[model samples]
Target: AYGFKTATYILDDGALNGLSNDAPIEKLRALEDQTFTSDLDFKAALSNALGDDKAKQYEAILVTAAAKMNSVLILCGILLFVSFYAVSIGPVMWVLFSELFPNRIRGLAISFVGLVNLTFAFLVQLVFPWQLSNLGNSLTFLLYAIFAIIGLLFIVAKVPETKGKSLEELEKLLVKST
Candidate 1:
């Protein structure tokens, strides 16, 4: 979308004009007739077509498109996080908490789990601003992606199969006698 938007903008403004026949913008001008297999392909081709000086002049255009794209991506991320929390994280914890404990200590076990969850939530809220300010958007998001992958690995390795098991069976599988 960004590449297409850029191509359209350049085409509309006649910015492709008056270049020496060998310039990268001239190559880009030729590409205006061809179909790109993917957005990345178009972007790569556009980058290849822009010489350093031309690319510098086009920086404002790319930055404007990037800002809009980042906003859209952030909105989508928030929506996805909310939906995932609603359907997965929020319920799964309670289910796991229920299944992991024996009847004698279920209530206490769940209270502990709930307390941990709340504490982590508060810590996240407290640290998020600092993370964003210190790491910047790209690195902050990269850190989130890394943590999500680590959590996924932990779930795969540590979480027991409880689908057909009773709470007692799950407790037996998940908990060891001390």
Candidate 2:
């Protein structure tokens, strides 16, 4: 629909003027900006207007444009998702790990916890396709959302504020809280 709109808009402004296919293309275009009910109707009109081969070429161009634009949109959405995770979840998770563990066991704890985190991340990637196929999109995404909400609750109820506090201070604070 978007590509059709763009193609029509371009064609309407005489973009294809003075060309060899001008008359036939114009014949297929809407004179009074009418709506096409379906592809069959449009194709039949185009075939009557300009024959099969020319109509196919025009349709191919429109379809290609729409497909390319759709791919670009999907790419943009993936980028946006990554950017949101980077800013909101990724760094905060590592910072929390650093602040939460005691100095005596910090290195070993961080290494073990980081490995476990990576393992879960790998598992999620591995299971995502299966979940999507079996549970469908809604359930898969809802499960992710539920887990995210649960993590948020855990952070709120359990993770202590390290704001304006040194590592030793934070360690002491956590010990006292526990």
Candidate 3:
């Protein structure tokens, strides 16, 4: 299973091959540079090549069967856990972006945020292969996890809770008078 997962990850064809339980860590560490015009294109290619839906179903079965959790299980668990954060963060960021700016400049603020978001997204795509090759998977993901924790902390500490507040109140709470 470990070998299969590693093959799915690192192989050129994105298929399970030449994998074994005792395969060297170097095999997993090896990466290749690839590019796509957009994230959607990359995702579509990955889903087609790697059969991500099949992986998801396999993971679900493994979880439901109460199998002995192995490396794949651990990785999948981490992936799913972070996936929850990914699914939640986008809408939260959008809502926060929309709410934080005053009505007078809201559109401009959103446009700015969108530009920044896309730029960083592009940068991540550009550097991810280099990060995987040079930093290795553990360190690469460690940095992501650390940053995610920091982001969560920042949101908790700095983002004002506007759940019960009216829009006008939120504007006053979030936006400055100036």
Candidate 4:
């Protein structure tokens, strides 16, 4: 969720900053044509440009870039985990709340819950960059921690167990008064 929100924010900012979407599409098409060229052609071009000693230097740069790429991959993995936790916990809490409500109000309650969740999500996307810029990484994470704590508290207080119940049983259970 965070990753998706970040991407949306970046794209929106790019549009605001006068980045033409078609420019990237055109650039990608040009890259597709170059990708079909043979490795022999690429090697010959490289050899002509770099000679021998410069080629060794280029190889060293490639190795350095490769090492940095590993660190990049690790950071991407951590971001993926954060996104998974955000999306998973939000739905789990929503489901738990829905199960606790009576059948007649469950749909309305779920819809209201969804609206609240989406509003927060939209605000998070809009304000995250500002938060990061002003508060820095530690305080940004602290805000998320506060949100998680509140959400957990709400879930513990209002959610009822649905474990080991069949679909019909759960439905009937929800219909009963708490």
Q: List the residue pairs that clash in candidate 3.
A: none
lDDT of each: 0.60, 0.61, 0.55, 0.51
Off by over 4 Å in 3: 1-70, 176-178
What's the lDDT for residue 100 in model 1? 70
Q: For model 3, what is the C-alpha lDDT against the true structure?
A: 0.55
Q: What lDDT is obtained when candidate 2 is compared to the true structure?
A: 0.61
lDDT of 4 at 144: 79
Better of 1 and 4 by TM-score: 1
Residue-by-residue lDDT tens digits, candidate 4, 46-85: 3454555543444333222212123454478577658878
| Residue range 23-83, candidate 1, lDDT tens digits | 4554466555454433344444456677556655663453233222345656677688789
- Model 1 TM-score, all chains together: 0.57
Better of 1 and 3 by lDDT: 1
| lDDT, residue 35, model 3 | 33
What's the candidate order when arranged by decreasing lDDT?
2, 1, 3, 4
Q: What lDDT does model 4 reach?
A: 0.51
Model 2 ranges with Cα > 4 A deviation? 1-81
RMSD of each: 10.2, 10.1, 12.5, 15.8
Instruction: Name the runs in model 4 displaced over 4 angstroms.
Output: 1-87, 166-178
The 10-residue segment of model 3 with minimum total lDDT is 60-69
lDDT of 1 at 151: 87
